[model samples]
Target: MASPSVPTSPPGPSPSPSANPEGFCALSPDDPAYRVFIDSLDYLTPEEVERVKAAVRFSDKAHEHQTRLSGEAYITHPLSVAGAIVEWHMDADAICAALLHDVLEDTGVTKAELVEHFGQGVADLVDGLSKLDKIEFASHQEAQAENFRKMLLAMARDLRVVLIKLADRHHNLQTMAAVRPDKRRRIARETLEIYAPIANRLGLNKMFRELQDTSFRLIHPMRAQVLAKAMQAARGNRKELLSRILESIRAKMDEVGILAQVFGREKSLYSIYSKMEEKQLSFSQVLDIYGFRVVVKDIPTCYLALGALHALYKPVPGKFKDYIAIPKANGYQSLHTTLIGPYGTPVEVQIRTEAMHHVAQEGVAAHWLYKDAEHSGADLQIRTHKWLQSLLEMQGADSSEFFENVKIDLFPDEVYVFTPKGKILALPQGATPVDMAYAIHTDVGNCCIAARINHELVPLRTELKNGDVVEIVTAAHANPNPAWLAYVKTGRARSKIRHFLRTVQNEESAALGERLLNQELHNLGVQPAEIPAAAWERLVKASGNRSIKDVFTDIGLGKRLAAVAARRLLAEDAIPIAATPGSLTIRGTEGMAIQLAKCCQPIPGDPIIGSIKKGQGLVVHTHDCPVIRKSRSHEPHKWIDVEWEPSPGALFEVRIDVEVKNARGVLAQVATAISDSGSNIEHVSMEGDPERLFTRLHFTIQVGGRSHLAQVMRNLRLIPHVVRIHRTRLEMEP
Candidate 1:
């Protein structure tokens, strides 16, 4: 059920300011504003009012000896915050929670006390509103990030938590004049970067604009003052222009027999300044500073008013937006257009029904503050719930990753695109097909390999634009590639990809580590499968690892060494065998934990040696590899004997440089020869100039072994245009 709406009738007189010894609010309780605050609460039931009074009385006691930087009683701060929530006509629990939000954080009171007095609902709200105390962070950024995470997690549980928090922040911003100058600037910047965007996404346009303007004023006082003066000066000069435009739109609406309310609207100073800075324009170059909103009685009349305005003034092409048809993700709906006004100046106009106007201005709060006769609060609540759920799903991420994703979500300048079924999907501006696929379904996103945009097949990284129809082509066996993380824009896609990669990488590393450990154990005449459970448990404790698998996984990932583990395990055997020379073998099943050195690509046909770098697992190098020569001079003990298993299963990378005559199709011919030799060229680059009658071509090809690479080179040398060919090794020349 929806919360009660604000009553339309004016309330009776409230108690005077003298009613409380400590201040009831930042302003005198007798002030007209404080009276309006209490009067708005008259709609609440008597029991609810009593609960609110109890909370206020308790908080007033808790903060009895405390005062704010402005010299007002600390209790007055929570009173103002509660007053703001009251203006929104929030439920009694919200108002009560707002009153006691800081009690548990700043006073001797506890959460249990709040629960005993106001119930668990109000206690949870207050706890959610309170900051984490007694925690020391290495940096302020870390502290802020953690604090935001805590609040968001609470909000995910109860939406009221954020509602009260936003109100609290709003009041704090209002009273920021009393804060230290440096601290004020820091808070204002954070409010603009974090809170303002959050308010905007929540459809709190009033709060969003107020936060932006207030933050901008503190962050750049001189710039804000200059912009304000410039706007005032322009208002005087364009007085007649704006007046005529409003009159003309009003007359046009009247001619169409549409009952409308029209008024001149000036863009906020910060908004104008942002536009100027973004577009790199001077004050005079920004033309959309003057605008008007026309609120009609119903939806049909909204379109009619738009038509009337268009008939009277020519609209700037491509500047018209029909948000009414495709409401924004925040449930905002309006028809916006920029028209060529009198004297060829541009004037922006918005047309929406009365209900739309309220929703556009008040956002989520409008459902409660206004009756919302057409739509219930459930609609906005559901959308907010979905958004919060996504945030909660991201809990698997660390603080930094979660914070980064939240910041990305805060600025969703959405683009509306169509699915193959013609269903419109709204995504952020730079969202790619990967993000779109993920939005459809998690499975579809994980298996997506290609996309079709406007019926043309394109790479998955292709960015989607508004109005484009996109279709994802998925393969059942396909999995997410690490490269996709670079282009995917949405938080869901990014988080999902990272989560999948982390899981897969761990599993694979563990498996590879197990094999390496087994080999090491076998060398010491110990069968891995026959190891005692007690022995494994003891080893786990000795290694300070969570489990036997974690020990192997870390070793496989080059974080530890299987040899060290094997020595430790064998040390308990009481029987030792002489070290077996050249015992370990490679079967190419080690996954990413074991890598073939790119300097001298080792294949089955080449003698190879393994070097266990500190953090990089076994690196295989050719026995005669120059890199081994350089390494052997230092940590020769790290080098170990390793032989390629008979019939290696995976392909190895080998570079070949071909000197060929510069001619058309020559590069293609070389590529075809390599392909005919049953090798795939992974990369190609040209070095020598074509105009010099010859060019040097470098090809990095995937081959089975040395024989396969030799076959590829022989095939290339058969070409009549080929001058010379040689295998390329990354070795420094003396």
Candidate 2:
């Protein structure tokens, strides 16, 4: 059963509707809509109200020409927004802020005006809720994430900010029907996916339910209608079954002397539909459908109530959980049990104290809901602090992965496992041992090689079960493989691993570029100081770089090719190299004439290519040509066509020189090793004449590409007869 946060009061929020007598035609400030608008001022003082009103009036005047698709005045949106905050029982400041929410956004009314009128508190809320107003995101996903991050910062400061924003969203969701269909669906989807979840977390259950149902109706109307009808039909047949189940549980609790309030709980249609969609379950197969929660007096009674329920019903052995003993980081506590009820049917039961029930439903909002919650205990406060801080910490994290992790972590279906020390940790249904490793520590993730679940060796990808004892196995030298990233599900693991790899890549890139720079500088016969640091800065900017490190890193990563930066730097110093490497070649004109080089027979997939020549080697093509045409006159030497023959058809001639121990069968073993890789030595020479005992062997062999040659060299190096092996790619020194 889902433990949504609930407000602690005796349901004060289904407030009676106050009356408004005057009609719109009278245009009086005393009208019902205007009165409700005025009533929203509970969060503000009278002076602030007047100031905010003046700002709203100014905004109304500015937006006078703008109208909504519903044909209502644009001012109606702000009024509706104000009404939403009022309904949230929020303080007057939020109501006034909501009224001006659009003023700074849709009209020229500025944040300055809002601050001048409503004070900085309300003004800050408006500014936080407003669009970035500049710097458009690259895509919808990026925009959604950026906007969510902004709201989270606001929420971290003041809960009422999100509360009011949710109310504003509620009103808009209600009015979304007036918008165009495509736009309506998009708006409804965002509201359903994000705002409703926020409302649920805050314990604004009414808004949460309504927003979800409304958005679902618009986004998937056919599925919505189908689900509604199905639920109705299911309720009709199961109404008696539900009542009997509730009675049995309540009677059992009473008999056990556990006084509690028991009520039948019905899952939301959207939730049921989502569960079905996710798990591919039929509505009837969705076993948690018939849950009924027992709200008790205290934590001890919660356990007693659970025992009583289990006595009355057959407990589903592994499905029981006791989060109350070790509450979640979000400060939720409850005893959960799934049982085989009458007729061997499955049903879930949740038991929690009044405080836990409230927190369960209201989440972070419960810190404000209960009278003494802030002072209740240090543990609750610490947990709440951790919860808020976690959100802030997670905001700097890669959001796409963070949201996914949160969904799985907060998902209604959870499996609670115990650490070796009896500490409890809740993981999603399919989380693996590696997920647990990463949860332990980022270094644990870096060194995780395998896991021992309950002291039995298991694969890193083994899915975890409730109550399983898991221990991670690590090697001192182990490191994260890119492949591990594919199977890792949790955001913490994914983000940590990605961060590790990115850091490694950056270090490697810097190191690699440093090496290349030294080599290139040496080739130029110029001291490193020949070009001043200022010149490097200018070269970076002329090449559109934010940092020299960025430029060098890009060059190392092949993102910014070496030739571009080399030419830029060389040209700035008035060096002799061409302005660009590929400017021209001697042999070709602006023509389609190109031919392959027979020397290397470099094929497409051979990691093969050609280089530009200033005078003679124009349009240097690889043995297998593909580039069909080129700007021949454009420093025609720059052009090259490349290809690779499949499997590198012929054995490559390379010589390996090794210093050997001169042991028995040394020459025979080396020859056998070379031939083992499908290559034969055509010639061999020995150094260190027979008496000295130390010897050298040079074997000429055939092989494929550099990889095969490396393998052959490795095999020969392992032989006892070989002390060292050296091979080099032949190149002519300038």
Top of the candidates by TM-score: 1
Estimate TM-scores for all models: 0.88, 0.70
- Candidate 2 TM-score, C-alpha based: 0.70
lDDT of 1 by residue, 440-459 (tens): 98899999999999999998
TM-score of 1: 0.88
Best by lDDT: 1
Off by over 4 Å in 1: 1-36, 136-138, 178-182, 373-376, 540-547, 563-578, 581-603, 606-642, 659-673, 689-695, 715-726, 729-734
| Total backbone collisions, model 2 | 27
Per-candidate clashes, comma-separated = 0, 27
RMSD each, Å: 4.9, 12.1
Worst 10 residues of 1 by lDDT: 6-15
